[model samples]
Target: MSDKVFNKKIFAYIVAVVLSVFCFLPCLCLVEAEEQPSEAPTVYAADVSVTQGSGTYIYVYAKNFADVSGLDLFVRYDTSAFTLGRATKGSFISSALCDVNAETAGEIRLSYVSVDGVSGDGLILTVLLYSESEAEIKDYKVDIIVGDCYDSGLNSVAVSASGCKITVKEKQQITETVTFYSRYEDVTKRKGDEVALSFYTYNSHGFASADFEINFDDEMLALKSVSLGESLKNTDSATFSVNDKTDGYVKISYAALSAAPSYVTVLEISFTVIGDKDGQTQIEFISSALYNSDLTAYNGSKSIVTVNTEEIPSVIVYPKISLKAHSVTYSEVELDIFAEKDTLLAAGDFFVEFNAEEYECVDIVKIFDGSMIVGNTAFKAGMARLSFIYEDGISGDTAIARLRFKVLAPCETKSEFSISGSKITDKDFNEQIVEYVGTTIVVPHDFSNEFTTDEQPTCDTSGSKSHHCSRCAAVKDVTEIDALGHEYIHHEAKAPTCVEIGWKAYDTCSRCNYTTYEEIKAKGHTKAVAVEENRIEATCLEKGQYDSVVYCSVCNEELSREKKIIEALGHDYIHHKAKAPTCVEIGWEAYDTCSRCDYTTYKEISEKGHTKAAAVEENKIEATCLEDGHYDSVIYCSVCNEELSREEKTIEALGHEYGEWIVDLEPTVSAEGREYRKCLRCEHREERSVEKLKNDDEELSGCFGTLDLTSIVMIVAIMLICGVFVKVKSRKSNR
Candidate 1:
């Protein structure tokens, strides 16, 4: 109230604070448009570009090594196609790089990453490189491959941009001259300079035809020669000369006579040499039938063979080629061709002539009443059917020549062919089928198979993986190798050979496989025989035995037993009286097991201690026959063929003595193994004894018993049957 009423109450509180800030400024602009709306998209930052991976060991992987922090990229080129390398704070991107953009040549390689993508807030780029302008500072060397911070957090990011082209990081050579302003009638003979014209070239594979000698680009206009046409290895050619006093971009003097020469392939030839009806200049030949000497440029389609020194001989027709067989009977038929050599000419044989007329009389004849083997004649095996005639020779247009042939059958078909029938030359049945294995080897037609873990044991590959199939079955859908095997064969013994029978044949790899091999192969003919020596011998052909193999004259070994004995058994009279084992005389029988105490002495062990009758095989138990060491169940008496002995006493040598006689022998314990008791005589009790023998050698004895125990038991059974129990067996290495 003092400074003018306090300035009117401070202007009335500043007009009530400007009417309360313009009444809340439209409710604060509707709450700031409901708090920050619109303007969003463009947030694709999970990698935008990066793809570099090429050859000779250049690798750089990145998916989540923290999105490569400040990951940069620079790469520059336009000096031609790539140069400037090395990075890592040397300023571009780094951590991986090599032999890259080696440096300038027609380059245009440019890879700048001033800021690639990858959001979720993780991306820092600052790479730059400008080419051909904007300060011409092409930067390079930055192989920055980075992504996957958990794959940039699922927002999806796969940055890749390494594609490269024009990759010949090595070649660059430049040579110019390609001139020859069309002129060659220099048929020389000149009088003093300036009229030189030589010219050359007639190529279409005919290589060199040199002549060249024509100049002048503008003195009087002359620029139509560019043919250095041939001599190559990567390629090169020549012919040039400009400055005829200028003014002839004769198409830039014919593109500087095929500009800068050396880039071969794409040679163009233009012509206009006419001197007779107003030479209207119209000759163009630009080479591209893939221009001979092997490619470098003629990028497809451009051969124009048109040189009509006035449309001469383009009237081709040739046709009328025949070799008909009025009625062919000799089988293999089909050869009908007739050519008049040029009657219109498309009957093939580029340069023709074909014949058969009546061909020389029945050569090796197979019904070919008249035959000169000029092309085809049949009969085969019984000789002559060698017909392979592609004759351009006018052979029999009608006089009857009918030449044609095609037939070749001998099928086992393919995995190198196999169908072996005759029980497969049984080497003991293929060594008993390579010692029992899940064999294989039936590729006789569905051929081509090569995956060798090697195992061909007498082959039976039960439908093949041929057993070693841990998992190898794609033999082209493998349908029929299955007769039943192949799921086992752990098969061992791998290299050099001893035994590895897998027979493994299911190999589609590089094909041509019949696989089925098992080889015990001691092969004298493979005889290990032992099924009772595979009997049924008589060259056994009922498959009973004898698949042919014989060769063991005692281990020269090879005898599944093949017959050869016209009449055997008499090596010195029946294997030397049947006493064998002197080791080799083909006798072999030698018996007697008790050398001393095993008491099996039915002996003839010929060291002769007690010799009697070692003879055998004929004792049908006769009165005079003998084979003394017998035991297959005793039965000796065939009429007086006596062997019942307890020390001979037929009624005491028949001297007859009757009475109560007891020659003491009581040690009986019989069960048929050992029983003996001779209680002598004592029996006739009261049965009419009218004594008609009053003094019959009077010798009736009484009973005295005190050991005469059968002569002390036959001398202790011959001293315990000559005791001995040994088993040495060193055998001197099969002596």
Candidate 2:
């Protein structure tokens, strides 16, 4: 009842009141937040259509999605209507960790979370539904309902989800007919002659892939070459392959991303007649399949072609030479010169003419020589003359020269190229026949506008993508995608333990292998005790051990760890099979890893040396009267067919032996007459001019006899006029 006691009571009362008010304020604020009107995030399911027995995607979009760290959603569908294939996360929450569960028959639950809250308004999820193969074609309803949702602060968030309708329709039937046929004119071919045939597809209905297997009489025909046509190599993802390892059969497969036309030439094949006698062989299509863009097989018919062989008067068929030019880049074109396989050429001269206004020659590389031959090329305004000579006669089935050009104009511009003046000769300088085919150079801008990604960009590295040509699958317009910088989160460090080392606090990227860490030394044990665990008994072929551990008496933490060994029971030796060494691979003696541990010892056998075949002549050049001959006699490995050694030897030329000069034309007073002597070994000739019979002094002295001054002046004037007329005529002809 004293004054001091009253004061103490008043202070205690005031402290209690302050505590009560502080606690009530939080409750009041939370209640207000829960009651406050807010626009709830909307989850909308988009209406979709599906084909009966096929699958379709039902997109779930978000409209008012805002700052959220976690979400849970459930989608319910009628079990009898359709089944769920899968639920995939959309780009809206791609950076977050997501989980989908469809354990229940009629419901699917999708849950997602992120440490850093996600905020966006776009597609949220995709649900795939597949109708039963026997399900009736009708409309079905789907309800997308929201479950638990939370914000970054762990506060409850309101989310509203809507329902969608799915309409299932009957699959459409294809009525178009696809046909496969061979195109070849039945021609009479002799043994060793080449027969060409092509296979085509009609009414393909925009097919994506084709496979064909062809059979022929192996004894009568030999497969020479197979080439894919434009339709097979014209897409960004095109692939073509051929398997002809087995005799009498060849299988060709072609695929492209882009759809092909109704009629397309698929492939061309060449064969050599090899039958001993005159006979006929049928190239039959054993099996054919054409797949449309949707991977549905199209009904097709097989085809066959016949080739007849006969003996006739031998006729020499000249090799056909061709020139091809194609754009390699947006600003570069590659020109290649090719000849048929049977062209045995020693020297040749040819010219390639093009429009100088549209393209400019940049470089020319001959494939046969290591270095360009001096003075071998003569470049004029619009033409380039290419001449080459191989001391050793060369046979060709490949490109002889590759020329690079800079496109001076737009890629769409076209320029014509003409090949002419080709004089090919044998080593003996005999004129050999060759047929030249002309071609045009068109730099096409057929690259597709849509780019295909070649490499996807990672968190720290850039990626590349390109637009590919629609007709040749050539890559162009390459672009680099920027790297997505890493998203990092802090990770706390663990304290060093008595038996384990620790690391300092660091940050780690969520998307990539990027981290920063520093190790901390382990704290050694202060107090100790010893114990044993996991004891194992030794076996007939194995050793065993038990874990020996030490513990700190203060914290009961493990201080030291080791294994106490038990002696092994002697092994019962087992023999292993030995393998012989091959020409390239080394062999090993019998060895084995012990049954209890990885322990083995063996001797390595040296690789067997190459089995060399006898040396044979290669790249031989016949000796000529004027040029030296050269050849390389090489030994090859019989097992691997690799060249083992080469001995290059030169053969001296046989010098020309000329006979005595013969007077073919006697000297005349008006002009000089020539005579020649020819070499005895080859058609080598030497000629010298004979001086005009010394304008016989008697005839020359009186050549201009008894002429008046007027006549002499007239004669001089006539000679001047004639000289002038000749010069003028020459100039006109040149122009």
Candidate 3:
């Protein structure tokens, strides 16, 4: 073979071995890489926005997470703009236990955990933010801070912080105005009289149309008609509508072709005074609306007109007198003389007459605003007269005089002051006609007969009372008051017991034979006693009992006798007297007995006492380097056939007994030294070292040393090749 070919083959084998080793190195490195720990997850905040009075939320996001257990998220925001509400867990942590503290004004914190770990990306928690009413219309900032965050492994999670911006907007607003009024100050009319009221309005902006609703006391006045006022009626194209279908209220609407004047009468309403009793009622404009030409709203004002019934006299011209009548028992009656109108009254004379048997005129005087009067009053029997003259005539309506009368006795009669007979003249000395309305006066007479009693009648007794005249000291009548029956109070009966007697309780009236009670009976004996002394003692192996008796505590009688068994205690053996078996001697028998019954028992004991004789070897053998030696030994009991001890003994090892060392293999120049020896009996061999000739010639040595196995084989193959080559050459020459 060619040398080049052989070298190529060797190079190929080297490359293969190097490649194989290189391949294994990468696999080992990969295993090491796989064993390295993973990085922790990150948590962060997300931005959000909300309007004033609107609700929104912010998110706490977790990224690159794995097996997360719990985390505390702390976030801060502008307290002036935002309010924290409920916090909700994200899907990643939805099933975990959670706690939220958003109650603090601007800060919110949440924590969540799960027994089963949470992992992956997504939100960890979401918190709600509500814009408060006082929140300003501007931007708000929410910032996040790192808190306690952990994974299922209890390792803290790394987190990055970010802030969110919230925008707030203002709310909307609205404003409006309308009004109504009456043309008259107040109207006065008699019952069954009709009156009219005109409603007007004043608006800054001229109005094209107007609508109004007016309400009045339905019991006092009934709406008769409603019509457009003259101001609105002049508009030829104007329209008017009225709704009087509902009692107590009239709704009217007026529209013009163009905007009406700023101040104009919008409606005329007529009503009839229907009720009989005299009263004043309000004609109120409850609601009103004025519209511009384009139908846009315009502001206005509202007003009310008071309507009074004429049954109440007017304070203008007529003079009126009022006398107040009281109970017949009243000591005196007063007459208040007043004028319905303000007038110049120079002089006036008044006279009042009452029943002579019931009352008498006691006094006459002028009351309030009487400084202008110089009067002399006279009263006698049942007639009273008063006259006055004013230095400067009276100008306004006022009380002229006050007359008082004394009650003479108890009587029912009518009395009055007559202005027809009296005289009233003005400063011009002209007579003034006065309208005087009179009232009946009654004076009650004192009664001698009166009912008197000390105590009121009750359900259980009759009470007596007397009727007599206290003033006349006359007994007009005497009678008795009926009695009321007694009301008995009772208690439920109690049941009888072994020692206590039972009874029922009740009450009885003192004035009447109304009695209530309950029966009581003697109680029986309650028995109790100590344990009986007739009980038999229990044996260790058997159970026994005796009758126990109980006696009554109150009667000293036997109540019950019952059997109570005593439990048996097992036998007790004495440990100190126990006999143990020995190697040669026989032990005494063991026995047990009950402590209470004295019953005995016995048990067989094995013999254990024994003494051992000295050991004697029976079989013995010699030992060699390769084989073990042995001997048998035993110790016998001195008093029995039992062997106390036995053993198989070893005679100690006879290690290799080698002869003198001799050279086993002669060392070559490149080889190490070697020598050996053998055991005489076992033929076991041992070796020793011998020195080798050192190699000084470099040309003679192979790669490792002088001709190692591989080099030597290669050299022998070369020699064979050289011989084959010579043979081939010879063969060729012969050819």
Query: What would the per-residue lDDT of candidate 2 be over residues 1-735, giving only the tens digit for each residue?
Result: 654675466556555655655556567667767888767788998788876655666888877767788999988987896987556677788788988788988998889998898776877777767777667788899999999999989999888889899888875554555777888878788888888989877666887877777677766889999887776677658997899865566788878887887687877889988875666778876333567778876654568898888865567767877787644665788877776756666678778888888778777788766323322233887777777676655555756777777777666566787776556776677777788887876677768789999999888788999998755557888899988678888889977877688899999898877899889877766766688878997876667789989878645777788888887786555556788898888998888655644456767899987998989999999888989999999999998788989998899998999999987788997688899999998968899998888656767667675554445545655565566556656755776
Per-residue lDDT of 94-167 in model 3, one digit per residue for the tens? 67898767777677777777778777888766666768866888877777776877777788777566667777
Every candidate's lDDT: 0.28, 0.76, 0.67
lDDT of 2 at 566: 89
**Which digits, one per residue and each the tens of the lDDT, describe model 1 over residues 194-294?**
22222222322322111111211122223455433333211334332232222122111111212222333323223233222211122222211122232
Give the per-residue Cα lDDT of candidate 2 at 700.
63
TM-score: which is higher, 1 or 2?
2
Q: Model 1 off-target regions past 4 Å?
A: 1-318, 322-735
Q: TM-scores for all candidates?
A: 0.12, 0.23, 0.28
| Residue 14, candidate 1: C-alpha displacement in angstroms | 73
How far out, in Å, is residue 365 in model 3? 3.2
Rate residue 275 of model 2 by lDDT: 78
Task: Find the candidate with the highest lDDT and give its number.
Answer: 2
Worst 10 residues of 3 by lDDT: 370-379
- C-alpha lDDT of residue 257 in model 3: 73
Over 4 Å off in model 3, which ranges?
A: 1-318, 326-331, 342-346, 354-358, 370-382, 389-398, 410-423, 426-430, 445-451, 454-482, 492-501, 505-507, 522-735
Better of 1 and 3 by TM-score: 3
